[model samples]
Target: MTNVLIGVDLGGTSTKLAFIDENGHFLNKWEIETDKRDSGKYILLNIVNSISEKVKELKIEREQLIGIGIGVPGPVNFETGLVYQCVNLGWGETQVKEILEKETGIPVVVDNDANVAAIGEMWKGAGKGTKNMICVTLGTGIGGGVIMDGNIVHGVKGAGGEIGHIVSVMNDGFTCNCGKKGCLETVASASGISRLAIEAVRKTKRDSKLKEWYEKRNQLTAKDVFDALHEGDQLAEEIVENVTKYLGVALANIGSLLNPEKIVIGGGVSAAGNALLAPLNHYFNQYTFSTVRISTMLVLATLGNDAGVIGGAYLAKTYGDHIRKIKHNSYIKELT
Candidate 1:
């Protein structure tokens, strides 16, 4: 029987799950709405129930199922599977690994969501074949993952690779959810881009597509800014330029520090594609250290929503191999 691994990507609104073989081929992938009721106590129960049903449906025997790798939306102790906090899920110091494994009777591995996404990209997406990489998500908020020598950089407190919280604005800057002011996230995230766009609309005297949209709807999204820039809106161009300056310069600092093989950009904002990449590359080169400028790459993520699940499967594969090695060693000793 082919060994199967369960990969889980836990989120605030929905939990994505997939069944994959040891070789990283996804057999089936699905999602379930995250029940936030009663402090999310039912979340693990729901996951266990789903996995059992899927195993029965696929006729996967207990021995053929190897392990589970779960990525959670919080700072997590990879070794202990303890989640420090998950504001979106109402979780605090949850014992994720112990609970999940006890319910499912399978070996379990847990990691930060962003870290696993980076691993996914390294294993099968943009950073494929590369060991040193950084993955940044530019959605409503910024999330980052750093990998070095083929392993994730989980700091002493499981808060490593928090790139977005880098303070970029020193004076009169916007505040961040982390209770900091002028964070890179305050200027470069999707919401941050929109904030800049709104400021431009209010301050600029020049006529532009953004102003027209603002006058009509009293609002504009980051997508609107990019779309307007494509139509030659000077205001949109300026907003993007400002956004990229914060992003590229921040990345330059990260590059000089780690000199990663590739820095993969993902999330909703990456959908801007070449419009985003061209300007980002220009500023990244302008500020990056010499050797880092030549060596590091900035690329778009390819796996989209599947990155997390694929990454979870990768973790499961590694965990299973380790477990197998221990069992084999024990058997050999018993034989002796």
Candidate 2:
């Protein structure tokens, strides 16, 4: 028996897929730019065809494959296998599970990508061996995943852990995609960081290399801010510091509520590395309760872009019976 599971990470920009054995070893991996012109159905059909072709090429028997799991960059009804909304891809109320199962003739499971990323990090990345953890993906928008007692926490609506939507600032806020003001992501995400940099340069009348850089590069991005920071540019450094402070405040809020064993930071902006992490850590320490004997570790995510794919595999392997057993074991231990 092949006992192998396939994991797919469906992102707006790229689609990543991987096949993994029971031991979490990758049997194969690949990525392709997402076909946005196709509707959700056609895109899924392509995935089905790709998987079938791969199986034939590898000479792997259909019976050997265990199951298929997908992680999508939007809200999903995990219990019913329906996507609530995929605004990034212009998808609405998609029945992904039914379509994938019909096309592939295999059991299909799906969840929000951020939730699966938490599973990935918990399984093989920074949160390894920790039963309780959270992952914050600091991309164009912040995405968060909650893992409590070793399982993904999907509340009544499967919209749990949407920390970005959480409000941290009430005024002087940028409008968010969700039509909210002062949303955490609007201030701390990569896009937010760049916006701050641009506004600072324009408002402060401060001497910054950013204007020259933007003239040369055509557009300013968070990467430019990091580069400027590296060059010891004062304005860029101040913007970074402010961004980190806001991010740390959000982290402290999350920490206070969940008190997770660790918080794993991921995504492109996290590429700022120590320059971002150090200041965020400092702010988190300053804001969070000091006498609570808190010991949550903050660390950078290790799985990178592969986290969603690997996490989807882990979810496929354990979402049903295995997850239930683990939860039961935890409850029993608490009772004992």
Candidate 3:
């Protein structure tokens, strides 16, 4: 029988679960709505119940499972499996690993969601065959993970590789969700790109395709901006230039500091493909130091929504057994 791992990606609105074998193949995957009532107390119960059902449905024996790995949308202590302050989930400090292990009678591992996504990419996606890289997810908000020397950099506060929170505009910039001004997320994420388009239309009377689309739809999307740019709209080009400039500078700074082998851009904005990467690369090359410019490559993320779960599975396969042994020893010692 093949040993399998369970990977969980816990988000504010929903949670994704995957069963992956030792060889990195996903055997099954599913999702469930996140029940945040009572400060997310029911979330774990739901997950455990779902996993039990899946195990029975698949006719998999408990002994055939290696362990479970989880990715949470907050800071996580890898050793303790404790999550700190996930505002979207309305969760404060909590012991995720201990509770889950006790409930399921299986070993558990946990880490930051973005960090797991980076690991997933490194293991089998865009960053494959590379040891050092960065993964940046440009969705509703920006998230980032840095992998160095074949390991995820989990800073003391679990805030390592927070590329999106990097300051981009120094002055007169829109506030970010993190309560800061001019964060890269404010200008580079999908929503941010749309916000920039709206601001441009209101501030200038530029004749552009975006204005007509906005007037008709009453809103614009990052895709709309890219479409306009592809159609040779001057205003759209300017907006893209503005967004990419910030991203380029931010990425260049990251390159200067970490000198990563690759930077994988993922999320909805990346779907723009070359339209997003072309100018972003131009600016990245322009701002990057000459010595490192030739070494770093910027590419799109290939794993998409599966990155987190895949990474979680990898974590379980790598660290779950060792952690479980350590915990068992500690418990025995305490009892004796």
Candidate 4:
């Protein structure tokens, strides 16, 4: 029987599941609302039941599912498969791998959500064919993953690629949810960009469209700021410059250290396309090392919402390959 890979991407609002073949094509993809009741105790149960139902509907046998790879929004301890303090999912010290494998009766691989997204982009998205790359997602907050030589760099505690918490601000800065102040997330994230725009509207004396926006809507979004910038709004330009300046410093530090081939930018903010890339690149060139400036390139993520699931499938595929290799070796040794 042909084997299939189950890919799961766990999010705060919904859980995405997909059936992918060994070739990395999606045989089927669907979603289910996440049940966060009881501190997310139902999350995995819901996934397990859904998988059972989907498999029956698709007429796939249980043995066809070689394995499952999942991405979650938290720091994972690879040794124990425990997820720590994932604020979005209301999780604290949960044994993700153990629970999922026990319920599904198949191998399971767990990793930080951002790390999987990076793996997806490298495997099939903008950074395709590149073994060395970094991925940064600019969503409500920032999430990042670093990859080198075709493998994710999971540090001792499996927190290797945390790019958002880099301390970009040394002086007075807004507090981050991580209980740290002056993080790059305070200034470079979508929420952070809007916060900066609001502060400018209140403090700056100059007449600006963003001031009118804040006066009318009583709030602003990163999209609004970028839209105004497209129309040549002076205030939007200054705000974006400040935001990208902080991003530049953080990226430059990372770039100088790893010298990755491509740095992929993904998430909602990347929808601004060249509008965001132009300024970010300008600042990046300024702060980056001379050699890295010419070599490392920045590009927007092409996969969008599918990055996580694709990454999860890749993990399952590789795991299956490893298992087959071991079985082959065992059979050969018995014959000998």
The TM-score leader among the candidates is 1
5: Cα error in model 2, Å: 1.2
Each model's total of backbone clashes: 0, 0, 0, 0
Kindly give the stretch of ten consecutive residues in candidate 2 with the minimal lDDT sum. Answer: 286-295
- Candidate 4 lDDT by residue in tens digits, 1-336: 768998899999999999988877889999999999998999999999999999999999988998998999889975566787678888888989999999989988888999999999988899999999999999989999899998888898787987889999998989998899988888888999999999989998998988998999999999999988988899999999999899888898888998899999998989999988998899899999999999999999999999999999888888778888999999999999
State the displacement of the C-alpha of residue 96, model 1, in Å, after optimal TM-score superposition: 0.8
Q: Write the candidate numbers in order of decreasing TM-score.
A: 1, 4, 3, 2
Q: Model 3 over residues 43-132: C-alpha lDDT tens digits?
A: 989999999999999999999888898999888888789998788888999899999999999889999999999999999899999999
The global C-alpha lDDT for each of the candidates, from Candidate 1 onward, is 0.92, 0.85, 0.92, 0.90
Ranking by lDDT: 1, 3, 4, 2
What are the root-mean-square deviations of the candidates from the true structure over C-alphas?
Answer: 1.1, 4.7, 3.0, 1.2
How high a TM-score does candidate 4 get?
0.97
lDDT against true structure, model 3: 0.92
lDDT for predicted candidate 1 compared with the true structure:
0.92
Model 3 stretches astray by more than 4 angstroms: 321-336
* Clashing residue pairs in candidate 1 (N, C-alpha, C atoms within 3 angstroms): none
Give the TM-score of each candidate: 0.98, 0.92, 0.94, 0.97
Can you give the lDDT of residue 326 in candidate 4?
98
